[model samples]
Target: MNAPQTPGQSLLEVVDLAVDYQLKGISLPAIRDVSFDLRAGEAVALVGESGSGKTTTAMAVAGLLSPNAAVTAGGVRYRGRRLPIDDDDAMRPHRWNDLSVVFQGAMNALNPVQRVSKQIAEPCMLKLGMTRDEATARASELLELVGISAERGAAFPHELSGGMRQRVMIAMALACNPSVVIGDEPTTALDVITQAQILKLLTKLRRELNLALILITHDLSVVAESCDRVMIMYAGRVVEDGTVADIFNNPKHPYTKLLIDSIPDPSTGKRISRPIPGDPPTLQNPLSGCAFRSRCPSAMSICARDLPELGAHEQGRVACHLYPAPAEARGFHQMGEVTNIMALENLQVHFPGRGGMLSNLFGRPAAHVRAIDGVDLTVRRGEILAVVGESGSGKSTVGRVITKLVQPTGGKLVFDGKDMTSVEGLALRPYRHRVQMIFQDAYQALNPRHTIFDIVAEGVRSLHLVSGHEAIMQRVAKSLAAAGLNPPQDFFARFPHELSGGQRQRVVIAGALAVEPELIVADEPVSMLDVSIRAQILQVLIGLRTQRNMALLFITHDLPVAWSIADRIAVMYLGRIVEIGSADDITFNPKHPYTVALRDATPKVRPMINADPLPGLNGEVPSAARIPTGCRFHPRCPLAMDRCRQEEPPVVDVGPHHQSACWLASTSQHS
Candidate 1:
């Protein structure tokens, strides 16, 4: 094995790498013609939506992918030597001290039965030839570097939060002080605050230790803040490669532009979303030309006839015909209206925390979290309503309350024609037929052991809407087709465990629609999906809503996603709706400082960060157990005035459908 770089030298180089899976009847490629470089002390981010071959590339780099998927062609050179990669004996020497990987899904990746300390120490002891005691001491030190305390070392993987488990992953990957580290979707399952901390720790470690890093993610913001260079992959191909600034400021491909436009912004009146329609092609029989041609807004005839090579355009490389050097694509500025639903008066919901069953026994939370406070909103028929906020901003809580999953503690909750704030038992059970909730993680809601037929049929059977197994099967087939799970016959026989993450999610959506819900409560439904797959799933939801004139209660953190489908928008902070209005006013004319900060934090290919410093929100949000005295967001609000500290602001009308809960917007406008 080679040693670390001496001063200035490239640490790793992968050239024209390709990986293919061989089967009895097919030879499918997973990664093709991928090339990138990383110098000592430098970082390169491999960015893409799910199924973009990013993971395949990482697997090749870390020597982890299954043998069935072989690196048939191309090169993975390290420190100028043809990699000792084929045999385990040749690869083991370089596995940890020279290179390592921080896998995504830390919770699942860690051994459930193992103690945190033991898990972290195993790799250190095995790879470094250190004794168990020595490795344990090093593991604690590594844990401290990534934000966890030494005390957590004794805890089991199940005892830790998602963020804590991820930190353990980072600690273990760094236990042997590997020179090159690759992290895949490192923050996918964590909350916004925890994600920030993980990113900060990764950033600090990279700079201070000069370790070469490869961050694999679907998030553009992570790339903007952490990496100097980036590679964008799509359907087993490297579509673009360049410096972070070059790619963001001069995105040359149509797919790249759409990917960037799909993020949501949270700053004024009402925000709109324009999610791309259609799913990516199956890898089994890939199309001849550009893989993105089917849904590309600027696609030309040339794209259908030829596989547009990842040719160069401007400073970076782009793999689309439209970017033949004079590419111009419009994005993120398009938004969609309420034709029917309205929420009247205001709604409030509070939940208790860590209280005994007796506290819940008393008909209240002994200690609680005020999730939705005095929120009045509407969702018109044929329209999409988006609710935006960072995690713990009461966004998901709002969805739960609307779906009647949680009873509101106060105020009116009038739906189509009924007061729903206090509904219970039979009334609520029937409402489940009309209003359904889509959870963030499909796996959480899906029964992994059951076949697709049983999963989707659960809701159908509960309602007792169908007669025999034959009739239930008919309804299941129809629902599956509606969610784009074609060949419903084949899919029904497949279990959730046998399907991909995206496919499992489609099954969940199919289950939701089986009940024939008129109003769907989508709580970060697409957050766990890959960027490209997310757009497809969203488009399906939108199509269903348009056809059925259904109302949507969308909750998410991404602003571009909201702009694509949301008819109107609502921004929540802490437990209250800070602002509500039309998509246009909110996306373009944001008044509240908190809204401005939230929007500014959003990362885009061409970020709106030309002149002003990208706003930095400070201080952790107060724990729900003890919220701030005044404005919940005041501690981090850059525009907080003296009045903001002593008193809370009331909602003020800004436009025909826009209102903001900011004292500044109220005082000047009213006067």
Candidate 2:
């Protein structure tokens, strides 16, 4: 904890800055007149969905511009001096010493070749002009300061988990104790506990050193909890800017309002979230006037004439024509429907426990662990059925079972009338195409050496019910376009290595669609993407359902996404669906305590983090290798009684299309 203090006044000032990237013969403006200030001990969060140019702005501020990118207009002043964007040599001295960047994605940001200590010490020895011994000592101190052990400093980037690597990255950024610390989606790779830890570390360090933070993130919850000020960006423009309290309380922009309203709350069952539709305008060919005009709910005829100027409203500001004028919202589907695309009757995934010899001898069936114990559900056609749960709640197992990636121990899966339990081999292949799955990790799911065309076309060629190279390529192009890749001709030839994380995911989605699948099982599809692009990919899924009538089984720990997208929500606890209902019923009038706990744990735009969600779903999800007895959640259930430990409660229907598998829900109504 002996890392040197970061000092100085209003640490960094980015005023009227506009940046452009050299593309072929054209210059594409990436950041447009972005202005912000950061002072010591204050955190300014840049909030936006993907392709908003938040990262480009941050990169410019950090002076990490490639030769391809240049500041087209305005400047970044650090403590009253303008940063030299053109000359790297001129910016060298101030780069790490004044403004240091902690990047997103622990997986990619850290070098595979270097160890954690070495990475931290590399900057220390090189940038800070420290001796090896001094650098090592500082690195150790920094690691400790970031809640990592000095003893584990020797671990390589791969050796440490994602969160640990992020902590290492933070430690490296702080190794020099730079005057200004810029965190770019720093907590994106982490889970809630790890996110909390990282945010706490950043806050502690900022306070201790009086350091200024320009935190870039998509999560409003993070902004609300940690940031003092927020700037909402869209398509390279700041649409809204304000104090967190001001913006959340009085969201002026339609995008801002949708962002706030789309968030989920635990006390309420499920909210009718109005997810903003349409993709952000192509940065390469950005729309004239307001970039958001095409997607804006309050889009007026005049909105197309000229870009709306940033107008003051109370304490904050918004850049929308109808802010002071009332206008009708567009592209929101409030009512959700369920029509049974796939059904699982008593779907159970069980593995044997550790009691080998004695259990075998006594013929106790090796003691089933019940990963998806006796779960029955239906995914309606053209509807999103979000399966919400904490980690280890069997939400993922259910997805895998439906995809036939994992064979269920007991159950009948009726996919458009075909029984999954008895289907196998060639017969299974048909069902596989009918219900495809997209994994959370795009890099791992995709072949590294393959081109975007090859990766996406692989599914088309493999599924081969058709013709020649031209025909296959045509299908590939169509699939890619369907998954949101514009001008498919340009993107098809590109390789995965050449694409960004969001682009890679789109390629995967395109691959999933190439088979012309009726349904997609997305296991945290957007969790790995940047905040800006995450919503875009999610909308792509929703749009697919709306346009092409593709059913989606969205399995995620992210409840807000579920609240926003899911038609029917199934709240899983331990290994079973503790609550099942229409999205309205689940978000507005949740009955199961587990459902309530999950809703509470998840952060919406206006997150109430001060209130603990009746204590952390309490205890680890009972091991799938050796699950507990009776009501599967009895060990952790807040309302568990003696009878609950010995007897399982049947799912009770409290209202139309609402069911909760809790003795409380079932018995409370009777009692």
Candidate 3:
């Protein structure tokens, strides 16, 4: 039986919480001395890099820790009542009824065979003892409450879009009316616009239902927008905790400051992303003193001698030796001069759409998925042009076309004023040697069986850039060092699986650099990495650009990241570039409604407690196979006019070297 509640207590409290994972026969400490309180209607964010114990602490609170995890020290409390979290049987009644968790991947958490409604209704029926009809009715209400129609509740998870599936998870989390809800990277996999919508929905539900929300996320921008209080965890300890403004504006801890600085904020209008030096320490043994001391730029002798207590600071608590020392300002490096490297004129790439055998048998013409309908773009040497959009927007397809991975259906691919559209067979060797592509997932991109040396030298040997094994080794070492892997000899013998995610990505970059490519097509390179690690990767790219004058065709869904590094930003929707301009123009003075929507969806790092909800995009990007008539964005655009639906808008120059393919661009210019 659960303990009786005491009055006037915090809605939820975790006092000196510590967790350990049983690896083999050894107990590896994952979370150490994490303490916080969550009152009703409060939203707190557990912010950290991967393996920072944010998720572990949350799982302990929700009594959803894995079988191998043990609460070695401390405990969780609900309304002053101690929870037997480690005891699964004892936590049965409290799970989902009082505390609930919306896992990271909705598809993985939800049952594949069962309907979404049935999954949501299962908790309602089992926990609340509601009849089948009652549960079904409640499920329908919840589905509508989270913006999904009740009629679509019968659809399988695969049938819904990524955004809709995430909504279903939210609805299911609220099925039993749980007072406290824990969202574990709920919006990590979503697009910026979709993420904005989900965050808006979560905030609204938290206020309306008077529920306490705990969000575990690595994205600090998301935290600043949705959370009231923020906790910065490093290694396995809560290094800092304070209000959003206090933490973001005046952080005392080095790790906290570095994390905030690492994030690429488009609103800042400065391309400054400094990565923290060194990697996170391993938890094989209990750490002494400060776990972040090795990586701390301002680490003192005292820090190594003793661990700092979470003492009261200015407006919150911080576990750091430097209590009041302000963070030093860093210099921002400007990108050098740029010239034309490549250009695409009316680029078009189309794949055969899924037309079943019946259509072919009926002698009907097959349809094509217009991945890249018609895009006119340019890449300049020593500059980064970011292509930003949601999935199916065809930004990635443009990169593939440039790399010759995907043959263009029509139009021309020009490099250095030379048309390379029909370049094929052995004739394309020079083009391949000049252009290299870096994929999103580095682990999958690299061969698991090959050593780091072999992987890096593969390009050198294939291109025959250098002769002899000694020359190849020298080239590989140089590339590895350039990619920020110092003492390259140490990693030469290691396999992909042996290295960390950041290290693996660095290896991929090293492989690309071994061939000395003139232009690099980086497609979402930093999306899979942590903030600190991402900063490192971004710095490496910027360094390479500075040293080699290498042009980059950077493609990503993150607008802030694009704005942080790119000299120019291109906004794509459906299969066309809706807006193209300088980063500042695209982010600040957007002419297209789609561009405005994307800018609005980007969460800025600021205090947003009880802030007005974001005006997110209306719906997901339409199917590429079924192209919308006229302007593709008109269907979801808030400022869409009658002409937008009836007539295709022509590209108009809105500013100096800035163009927008929107009817409103002309109207705005005239007005």
Candidate 4:
């Protein structure tokens, strides 16, 4: 490791760093001309899309690049001493002793069979040269420091939740008290409340340890709240570098400005989604001027002929032709008439829990998992209704019931004056033609071996929507174009792997559109996309609603996203609707404490210094099989009272078309 860090000194500096990956004997540029500096107690965020070089740059700095990656130019220096980042053996001594990395996927990064405590202790014993007993004690302390109990450390990775597994990773990263810690999308897969907790923990740790941090993530909201400095990357280069306030307040680069604008901001009223026009440039090609010229709205002739170098502009640095020359700076369409198209009346779906011969012999009762309990909802034509909640809250399960994927154990589903309560098998084919579902993961939902054309044509062919080959091709092309893939022919022959995360999602949307469904059940559609691409996808869905007069049952864990596009919002807690109202009322003037906590947990695109703790929940959601009586959410509710523990609250109408199921709803009404 380098010399001990001095107070208020530069902890790490990377100068003109470049990295290349060997793909089939061809060198592909992953990072080009990246430079940054971090002080002893500073936090910098690398923000961009999937192929934008944020993760690669962070990996290079942490001396943890992949096997095929090579540092072609420049180097990383720690405390004024050069680090052999390219040489794995030479970098070992300094890897965890000075710099550590918390990878993105906690499940994949951790060893499944090993106990979490043993995994955390490995680094301590190996790097610090501590005995087994000392390392074991240190592991317990680290777990406690990360807000996880020491007793839980004895559990295996599979036994923990997503947030707990991530906490274990964080504990492991801080095993040796490293000078710098790099978090690569640490909270990407977590819920809003859990995300807030992790961000809060990292902030607290940074303050206590006085360690510099480099966070690599595409979520600008997270960057706004946690980062001191921001580095915007695009197409293998740093396009903008500045303080958080400078970047968010007055972004100079067109790309940076567009990225900030593309975010789904519920605070703004009735804004339409406008995605960046085109795709990012392919880095494999040699000829290029400005990489963002094709998609930039302010692009001039000079931008196509010459590249803009990173230079000082006002309070920040930006690589844009407009900076040196001049400075200039997802909601559905409302329908004229709205009518109820679908309604759920006291819907309940109870799945039988696992039971075997051994369990029967032991006199164990086979309980049912209450996936959905007493849900009453309605979806209007040409209007979007969003169901928002955490995992296991049954938001997705509600969508499944409406789409007829899962049979409801009890209750009624009325659609277009037809009762679909007990519809199943071949009898449900007609209903399926009018209603379709878009799943969360596009990769898993689609067949990898099939071409884009074949995948889109499958629904059309199966439903007998088109007759001949030529008619089917035309139908597929129309759907693809409607989903925003221009010309459509270019992607027809390509497989799922050939497309980016955003493009793959569009294909899934196209498949859904090919059937020409009047009502679409989208479950976490844009949850996997970058902010820029997410805008495009949301626009496509919203556009469909206007053109086809379609009704959307959007299910997601993101309240802000739902607020941006939905006409109505429903908050779910423990398989029950806790609150329901217009989007504005639900977000701005919530009657339920759960809704209030969720809104507070979401990180905003505003500056906050060592921010105060969020008013989120204190514990995880209870198991469905063993749900608490009285109020299902009472155990984790901050405003719980004696009545809340003894009797379940009845749904009360707080306003016109607004209802809340809380004991204090009567007093909390805005009136």
Candidate 5:
């Protein structure tokens, strides 16, 4: 391969890099012809779906690739010198001094046994040849640089918050003052607010220290918010590369456009059901032409005959046959009349917390953890109502209560205009048949020992919904076919482990459909699946809701997912519904401060370039055992006033169908 052109004195350059993992005698190519340049103090982001070779490319660059993996072609160069990444001894000097890495999970990356200060000081003492006392002092200063208190440096990893732990990792990465930092999914598995804070911190440090940063992430919003340049990878290849503004605004590649379109726009309440049709090509069994030809919506005959080169387009460099790109837009079908199918009135689910033995002996009443406190919600037939919140916000609890998996401690649950909160024994049997649940982890929810047919048939058998051996089989086959698992007979005998993530989720959905429930409580059903498959599962749910006229109570933490699929949204905060309205009302004209923070924290592609750090919440969610006295969100609310701290706010009607439990809603609305 010919060498690529470099701009100025490139700090780091990757030219036609290729990597493959060897298993037995077979070689599976994980990265192919991946090349990019990073200048001093520049921020570049590698964005793509999971298993799209983003992580593999970063691992290769950092010399952290697995032993089974080998670089087949090209080289990684730092300051025009070829890096011996394959040779550990040769790369040792450049590891931390010239380049460093902040791994994905900070909690798992840090040493739990050692003090954070000691962990941060180790590199300084060993690499920089500093004294023990000097290293300790330097550690404190590094912590301060990341906005952590110097005194907290002595704390253990577990004692610090998620954001603090990440900050400590950043401090450690900067210990030897590395010129370049590669962060591999640095903000993965973090809350939205924490993600924003970390992104802001990374951007701040990049400018302050004049360090080049390579952010490897699946989240496009983070890339748009933090990076100067963007590279979209797919199946081990750089499909698109250009300035952030150029790519996001006018994406030339079909895959790049799909990714941007898939991101649920908080300003628009439209569900994106047009998922890329096929799975990514298997690298081991090398496909002949374009890797994305099977999934491309605008694929031509040439796409299958010849692979497209990463040639320059008007906007940027794109690997596609269709460009100047043709506009390809899709829309969803409208639902029928909205009639309330299920309602929760002043619902409360309080679990009694256990006290010490002394308190028990003294007959002291145990304190209660108000999991769901006076949350009034409704689900209309054929409509998707999403309950969104951070962890421990009681969104899942509400779903459980609706499905009767966990009984509510107080208030009423009305279904089909009938009060069924207090009903028990045989009287409650019908309610169970009318409401079903779809769990988040499809692998865990499904029994490994059971076959696909047995899993789906179990529900029909237990409820006696169908009779006879053949009748049950017919019912199971029908449900399976409805869930997009066509040719049901083919999948009937397959085990849970044998199926893909998307297929397993389909099995779970088939089981729910077997019961023919009027309302389905789906709790983060697609969170574990890939972004491409997530759209498929969401499409299945939306189709079932529209075709079956069933009400769906969708509980999730992802704002974009909620915006994409939900007709109405209920934003939960510390067990209460802070905001409830149509998706448009909640997304476009939010009234509550918590809702606003959530929207702002969500990364989205802005029309113009934004240099400002994304705004983040002040603190983590408070403990459910000891929630704040008045408004539970007041502690971290940006619009919190004295009255907010003093009293619990009443739910005020902010719009036609919008209600917000916020005092500031009365004075000023936050959009």
Candidate 6:
């Protein structure tokens, strides 16, 4: 086997790097013998699941490890010179001038009190020995270079949008004209369109400045779209390294294959996807052999006894017992049909905007924000209904309204043949127990001070569904086990803060299950989770839905996810259901222009060198306060006609159980 070679002189080389964190007197390995290189003007991506040490490796290279971490072995060299990264005083001079990092969550990284201009100028004043005025002027120029207006440099971080704030972070990273930049999950919480814009900007800047880039992220699509080379990490080890084409088209390692297959692609219709079973090994415990052997489908007896060295396989390098051996293809689960359990007819939820005192006194009514204006949808037992749309499309609002968290201004909500729109007190209590909600942000949803057992038991006890302490405990344990938190005793006493993001979400689901609800409304349940964990959570949801015959209302903005797990899909735009049909019909034969545009905007796993830019919508989502006249989506629709702008379109049946609200749907067949 051969080691990976660089085409040009190595700009940054990490040789046999190992790092450990000290807690009390115990040392825990966070990164182990990881080696990679970045060439001048090249972009490399580190891809892996959560706790895979991608961030730790980037931090080690950038000399930004926390206080308790120590570099036990190896070194990081820049341009043939080993850097004294551990020594702050020695590395200070070369920090921002030679290398800089755009940290995750730009809003949290920037100072709220200081203006953005000053924040970007700090590196110029300290490292370049520029006067304050000159540094400020340079900061303005940097802002302009990153696509932000120089006049907005005086604004605070809070005043900028999420995408703009990230651009500011990039401008700061390039403040001193650094030759290398490291971006850690730079597009973590951004929408698909904004994410495309950011990736485009990064690619343009890298080419113009000839800068070396290291991007650390769990999104494989992003890596495929923007990176030249790819490195797969797992349990603190670099399992595979190769060009994007080599890795994505023909992976060698089992873990690498699983990671690639786990991604749900809308371009392809409903490919079979299965989450990799089991959790990553805890770094605190030492293992004799491969850390991923327990989860590897192709694991052999020798895998548990001997550790495999990363060696050349095909055109890339891989570390696995079955390196050259082909992996077995896995089958997908098939969903069955069921009867409708809940239905919404002409749901309307409008909120009045604020009006001036003079207008209010004069008898003018405040304008209404049509959050969910006249939308019809349905959920079936043992079925997954995925409602997908961009931000401000009222996807989450529909979920909230279904859960009774927000009352509808005018609509009929039929659950179990009973109208729940005006139900209250005892009537509402029974309905609440029948329906449950799983929020997007698990950390915020779960009580920090409560134990896992108590959090799950709160609903059971409050509803008085069961009697006695032992009975409650039994129910809690059963629910926990159902949600995949096995050996409930181990997690019963743990707090929300002690669990990982995926674990916390499972806990939330367990709480919802404790009450034995027939319907579960999960709003963006796994958006913030890593790819592997996201797959696991989706599997859990599907498993529970089948085992218990419960209905799932999965609300998300990711179209591929909807295609992967949904029985039916409803694409929303400006408070209306623009399209509704089976997952296959919605993905493969989309009728509306809005749905087609969304499908095109989604990023898929492809080679970055010749990949085309996403044909994203032209303008931002129209505000609900003043939605566009006629078809609300006409402003951004590529196929919009004059009639679409002047007259609202009615729902037309395009196929069996398929409907689209577009003017052209009646006369033409769109992609």
Looking at model 2, residue 277 earns an lDDT score of 84
Write candidate 1's Cα lDDT for 1-671 as tens digits. 23546534687888657787777634577877677778887888888878889988988887777867877555577776667555567888788788889888998889999999999999877877789999889888888888899998999998988888998998888887788899988988888899988888888887777788899998876777778888988888888888899887778777777766666655433256557678777677576567888888887877775555565566777777765522121111111212344474677777766776876678764657777766777766545789998877888877877777777888777777678778888767778888888888998788778888999999889888778998898789878977878779999888877888888788888999888788888888898899878877887776566335467888889876876667677888887888887665666667777777777877767754322443688888776766787777888887788888888888898777689998888898889
Can you tell me which runs of candidate 6 are displaced by over 4 Å? 1-338, 356-363, 607-615, 669-671
Return model 6's CA RMSD, one decimal.
28.9
- On the 0 to 100 scale, the lDDT of residue 308 in model 6 is 61
Cα deviation at 541, candidate 2, in Å, is 0.7
Worst 10-residue lDDT window, candidate 1: 327-336
Per-residue error for 488 in candidate 4, Å, reads 0.6
The true-versus-predicted C-alpha distance at residue 279 of model 2, in Å, is 21
Question: Each prediction's TM-score against the native?
Answer: 0.49, 0.51, 0.51, 0.50, 0.50, 0.50
Model 2 regions lying over 4 Å from their true place = 1-338, 354-366, 608-616
Candidate 5: the clashing residue pairs are none
For residues 338-445, what per-residue lDDT tens digits would candidate 3 score against the true structure? 347899999999998877799889978778999999999998766788999998899999999999999999999999989999999899889889999999999999
lDDT of 3 at 594: 81
Candidate number with the higher TM-score (2 or 6): 2
CA displacement after TM-score superposition, residue 325 of candidate 4 (Å)? 30
TM-score of decoy 3: 0.51
Give the per-residue lDDT of model 4 (tens digit) for 216-321: 9997888787879999999988899999999989888888888888887777762665677778866566335578898888999867755566777778788887
Tens-digit lDDT track for model 5 on 166-190? 9999999999988889999999978
Q: Cα RMSD (Å) between model 1 and the true structure?
A: 28.7
- Please give the distance, in angstroms, between residue 198's alpha carbon in candidate 3 and its true position after superposition: 71
Number of the candidate with higher lDDT, 1 or 2: 2
Candidates' lDDT values, in order? 0.77, 0.79, 0.85, 0.85, 0.84, 0.85
